[model samples]
Target chain A: MHMLLNTDQSLTQRSEHALKDSFLRQAVQFTTERLREKKEESTNALGDWELWRERGRQIRAHTIQYLDYYLDQFATNVEQAGGQVYFAKDGVEAAKIALEIAKEKRAKKVVKSKSMVTEEVEINTVFEKEGIACVETDLGEYIVQLAKQTPSHIIIPAIHQTREQIAQLFSAEQGKAVSTDTKALTAFARQKLREAFAQAEIGMTGCNFAIAESGSVVLFSNEGNIRMVTTLPKTQIVMMGMERMVPTWEDLEVMANLLPRSATGQKLTAYMSILTGPKRSDEKDGPEELHIIIVDNGRSKQLGDPKFQAILHCIRCGACLNVCPVYRQIGGHAYGSVYPGPIGAVLSPLLNPEDEQVQELADASSLCGACYDACPVQIPLHDMLVYLRERRVKTQGGIEKVAFRGYSAIFRHQATFQWMMKTLRHVQKWSVKDGSRWSSFLSRLPIVQGWVRSRRLPYSTQRSFREQWKMLQKELEEGVDNQ
Target chain B: MNREAFLLHLAKQLGRPEIRNPPKREQIGAPDHWKSFVLPRKSERVDRFCQEARTLGAEVHCFETQQQLQEGLQALLTSLKPQSILRWDHTECPAMIDSVLNRWKSRIVDPIADPSQALHADVGITTVDFAIADTGTLVLCSDEQKSRGVSLFPAHHIAIVDADQIRTRMGEVLAEFRGGKPPSAIHFITGPSRSSDIENDLSIGVHGPAVLHILVKV
Candidate 1:
């Protein structure tokens, strides 16, 4: 989603931009808080939740470890079931393959279900460039699509857009002012998308899990738009990450249990469709032609990485985003990627190791471990964050390296630490006093200005902690002598 | 791109040679203890399923006798007031339900027919193959006779299930599908289609049935 016009701006610059949008902050907070509370209740209700997380982790890890085999098995089975498979090493190729299919089928319109992989590949942009109308069928996705922006959250794509904003989008589409009532807005999307679904020549979806046993493509959704996308069209294309594999149907049960509870607090999403292949010879509905594009991109890079391989186990449930403190404060666009939040912090960097801007997303988390706990498969994102930070600094030397190095050298020696503190205290005098506190000027200083924008610099406290403690001890001695 | 190069790179990345056969799994499905959390009796399972369905915002009606079923079906059909009804030709459908359908103008969902028939129908009636109590899910396997459109597309859906067909957990039903020539589509529907996508406001019937009426025959 490199939607920043590919500018040379830093993460803080984009985050500062997001921070200026009070509506965006409130919208992000509102949704994350609601999702976090629901996740807490749902996971607790599931009982022995950690056991489920472990099982989920085991299945994902085992499948990822033997991914080449499962993928081979899955491909053979898909072919046996009368479906075709294509392999792409990266996003551009994947989008190219999908477009070729569209061109071959002479498809003029494609209705799409919500798929982060599709967003990552920018397939809609690919089709739009060719004058093919690709309509996003999911309600949140449709809203974001109308606004011409990428999804901000995985589950709730328009998590940063309020109802009024959505209403405005719909109104512009309708050529009339649409009310902000949820019912009216939903009705409009249903009516408009239904017509598109009925006429669409091709349907595109993202695979939630590809079963190696039966070669089934499983999709979970609450709005049922996925069903519409898969059913109403003549040909279907599925964008799949190479790692989205499970060995059998039984393992799907595990994912089915964990994903819904983690994402939206549903015991099961309203619709969990397992489509094995194109419709059987006698079947009425479902796509007649099915093509699955397995994209590797940089996923292969994580296959053997001991420190980063676990990231492949992520289900894209967005639970990590809900509990991430940094994601809550700044929202998804600040990460400037298709994925956002703690998982995004690690994944965006791992997915695009060469992009220095993407690498900075690794620092987006607070290292709170909340994301790890909230994760359905228990990816140790906090630990991975440290690992990414280490790799980043080692590979790409930056001003931050010098800053932290100086910080470490000074803090380890008392004399230098005291000297630095005294220097800060003296320099702090240049800072003008605000209503009740000093260091308002310090916040304007170059190195720490970003840090002090919303926070106080604490005035360096005039005396160090050790100095204050020594004076307190002498005062206690004097009091004892008096007694 | 060549598939061989793609998978080979993956194998190399995984630090192993290519694997030809499926590896034996150490763990499968849900944990052992979850299977033990089963209801003791059929009635208990039925009650649990009904309770779950109601909690999930579906209307559950239990019928102990043919008369009750007839009355319930009549009331549901009349209340919905559907001018056209689409149904699946489930071989296992009860004789009574067939006779009941005969009273109304209904036809089996014919694949060869125009799809717009199902698209325009206000109500769809289908017999669920399995009813899971643990999550109140209806498992519908689509085939030549059992169409997916019967359950989807309609604004209202009426699913009939035998109470004893209800299982304790989703895994139990899933375990049955281990090696069978499974249907092309197996839908696990927990509730009527819904979305909270618009500013997190829950809206039912966003592209699927708004009202899910479950008829459990005890």
Candidate 2:
């Protein structure tokens, strides 16, 4: 299995590769546009959207603030329902626990619905190494799995693949020619996955919202694969982030209102399954054994940190990705993390702060604040990105610190700043061509080369802003005298 | 790690030595104004439910009596010509519909029985617990008799709902679970199984029922 985290290449190199792929650029742009427009329309239909967002934020904040208590209550309820709960400190432990469960069941095949937490742990690779066939049942996840790629987007995993590409992947898997038609391709996947669903002994799913009061895991999906994954297999395993919980079903009502509207512009997705536990003794067709693995995986680090605590409020609706300009252009692969876009930029570093490669993802955003606006729960992702950048600079201590120090020294005094501006005017004159236009020499300069690569450096004026202000003042005084 | 240790570590990380009591909540659910949002009449709610259900790509039929409902089911079954039919074992559900279903091989799903029969059944019928008008959603709770598979595994799902069961919004239905013990599973189905995973192009019936028919009795 191919993991999406390719830290061997830096962010710049990965972005350059993504920029070269015109298909990826167009596909990402098209899908994000559609999703963004849908979110706008749906939110518009539900009037007073800001009020709704604030409610969402409040509910999430309240839940996270009391997460410890809620987690305890939730675990107790799950056990009461004849279910087992496992708390994993990290991804490695989570994967190990899942592997142990599989081994105990003697499972040969496991059908999985899409879950970002599983990807964070690289669970598929672990299961495959243990000789367990892990099949991704979600249509988009199945496509990417067949192509040996990781999900590019949160909601729509295979947003980067074109129909022709998917047809090729399916054809290769089936060992037969398949048409590029969406219906035909989906039909083939549906037929193939049905067999896998029946044959698999264990089913794995990601929890969207785990209600503490009822000890139920709520799932939102347009396709029915998640339902199948939970229903067909005898043993059901749920991989949930520790933060993915709500205090009660009432809170779930608010979340159910916001998530689907923000995600696909639907009043609700086609299916919203609230699985409380394994099948009742008298029930006909649900999993008999239910195991929920709650993973921290660096989430605990943000608990008391004021700047990033709000990040745990995220519902993983992918609204931030839809409005992110940087994400739309470069696509998800460039971020080089399990998550991509604004959330990824902030989360990748926070989740694995020690890794220098993941730390660099913080620099991928423009900090335009669109992500904050687009977020359903109003998580200030843009602000979190800036904080990550500051932390990185403080720890790494690079040329940026020296340059900023020198910049502060010059700007702290008026006379020194004026002197530096006067000197810069002379340097600008040397760099300008035809006494008016900016020349390539400015871009060639070592000091400004990095900034000029992706942007145009505006030509410096003959006079500084202070000098211009002085002349404007004199002109205003002369005009008053004439009057 | 075990549950107690994990919670303890989290409490320490959160800067509390022990689990802190839940803070006082000023507000709990949707905004104050939203709580009052509801249709005044049952007929209007049913009308809106049917309209929204059709918009989501599900077939809706309304009847004035049980006989009309049976006739409607008969016409639908005769037209679709499903190879097999699966019905839930519920007292509220019209048992006489079996006469119409007798044309095809039919069975009443026992909650304790093996569910393999649903995998091959072409049509599954169940009476909905509740219906939401705002989103045209059906709420189905799993029990010994009302198997989750009956509504899920078949290619086509036919849900029979009484007009009085229609509610105004999702919250109204969710509110019922606030202080009660929830069932093993509660499914809120809006439409037939659909996916836009393939390049954002919508495809129907990926893994569950492709066609959903909701029969509302007045």
Task: Write one digit per residue (lDDT tens) for candidate 2, span B32-95.
Answer: 8888999999999999999999999999999998899989998998888776677887666667
lDDT tens digits by residue: candidate 1, A1-483: 242323567888988899999988998999999988888888888899999999999999999999989998899889988999999988889999999999999989999999888887888889999999999999989999999987888889887888888899999999999899998998899888988999999999999999998899999988889988888898999999998999988898899989988998888899999998899999867889999999987888998999999999999899999999999989888888888899988988898887777888888877989999899999999999999999988889678788889899999998998898888777665544331344565555676676666665565445778889999999999999998
Estimate TM-scores for all models: 0.92, 0.96
lDDT of 1 by residue, B1-218 (tens): 88788889889998889988768788988898986778889999999899999998999999998789878998888787787788887677677777777777554444447676667678888899898998889999988778888888888899998987899888888787777657788888988989988878899999989889999889
TM, chain A, every candidate? 0.89, 0.96
lDDT of 2 by residue, A1-483 (tens): 123578578898999999999999999999999999998998998899999999999999988888889998898889888899999999999999999999999999999999999999999999999999999999999998988888889899999899999999999989999999998998999889989988999999999999998789999988899999988899999999999999988788899999998888888999999998899998778899999999999998999889998889989998999999999999988998898999999988898877877888888888899999998899999888888988888889788889889999999999999998788777766666333345466567776767776666565657877788999999999999998
**Deviation in Å, model 1, residue A386 alpha carbon:** 2.3
Candidate 2 stretches greater than 4 Å from native: A1-4, A432-447, B105-117
Q: After superposition, how far is residue B19 of candidate 1 from its true place, in Å?
A: 2.2
> Which candidate number has the best lDDT?
2
Candidate with the greatest DockQ versus the true structure = 1
> Which one wins on TM-score?
2
Q: lDDT at A417 for candidate 1?
A: 89
- lDDT, candidate 2, at A172: 92
